[model samples]
Target: MSVDRSYIRVKAMLVSPNDDGSRHLVSRNAPTSENPLGFHRLIGGSVELGETHQEAIIREVHEELGARILDLTHLGMVESIFRYNGELGHEIVALYSGRLEPAPADEGGTLTESDGSVVPVVWRPFDDADITVPLYPAGARNWIRSSLT
Candidate 1:
């Protein structure tokens, strides 16, 4: 069998420290037919042609969460292999660490995906989240924690 080519996915991740000094994260899981096992994931997407990883992350976070990333930092990339809908998948994931600038209280934010899927976005403490849902790429939690330190 021929091996699958690498698919690149650019992700924008934010760990925001609230006034109480506790860090909260923004995550979502838009269920698609192709993704049989549903789980919440980081806010990110594919890097389009001619666009750089930084550009894609910025665009994705804005398009998906309607939030802007501030003091963005490149935390490096993580590569992994997995399966979706019984098909093997390989991804070169560009992971970014950043903080979300406070959104205006007047407007509620939303997510816009390529498939027109709407997933729930939730913010919770780092420790409180890992138990509730399985995060993709496995290394995301570590990176998120490292961002705040």
Candidate 2:
């Protein structure tokens, strides 16, 4: 069965903070024309058919990072409308907060996507100044910032 790229997608993502809550895990994306410097986003993926957003988040984290999420808490939702590569895309994202079990190293690591492409994963401080690579789903970033204060 093929999925429609133009249709708005429903996704579940996690805001996984490190032990001290000073940093969060993010996946670095390749540079696109819309964002020449590229960008970073929280780890998680699409909510599959018949899956709850919470269940989707757990499955996605395990699949994307081979890690488990604990103490999951519903953060909120955000609508993302943007372009990737050259195609317009839209997503309604359900966000959650949690901690990663066996967190990735401070030096960061790589994670393979469902498409088998490997991307770098890193722990970034909330105050990171590289605005060129802003955290995506702008609303998600705002939520994280508000929670940190």
Candidate 3:
């Protein structure tokens, strides 16, 4: 058996403002992650074969957040070289920002993985991301922060 390596991947940052008038970023707890941390811990994933980056984002939102994005504007591309568990990994991930049309009406309060994995999504202000979540691809965190400018 051979390892399946993905040289390319795509994702989206579906964000919204909380009732307290603070912004929150969203991310999906990856299937491989056993314990995922904070808000950027909301919804996202890789682009499937023949699927465009935008399509993957849409699919991810539906599957993870149960919410459709009214619009997704390209934020930027993030090239990342990082190590996880001591293994070096590199990726050029396409990043985009979308406005959630409305709070997801799904009965579940937290996002669920399609594979039956469940991790709670805890919303935190942008300023709190560092203290709360362990965002991957370091560049993505920077892109998200810069896009708000």
For each candidate, the alpha-carbon lDDT, in order, equals 0.63, 0.85, 0.58
TM-score of each: 0.72, 0.92, 0.70
The residue pairs found clashing in candidate 1 are none
Candidate 1 least-lDDT 10 residues: 101-110
Per-candidate Cα RMSD to the true structure, in Å, reads 4.8, 2.1, 4.3
Worst 10 residues of 2 by lDDT: 1-10
Better of 1 and 2 by TM-score: 2
Per residue, candidate 1 scores C-alpha lDDT tens digits across 1-149 of 23334554444444444444454545556454555446666677777778888898888877776888887878877775766556667666777766776542222334677676765655546665445556666666677666654
The Cα RMSD of model 3 versus the native structure comes to 4.3
Off by over 4 Å in 1: 1-21, 30-37, 102-109, 128-130
What residue pairs are clashing in model 3? 27-41, 27-42, 27-43, 28-43
Model 1 Cα RMSD, Å? 4.8
lDDT digits (tens) for residues 1-149 of candidate 2: 23466899999988888888888989998788888888898899899899999999999988888999888899899999877777888999999998988788887587778888888998878877655587877778888888753
Best by TM-score: 2
TM-score of 3: 0.70
Q: Best to worst by TM-score, what's the order?
A: 2, 1, 3
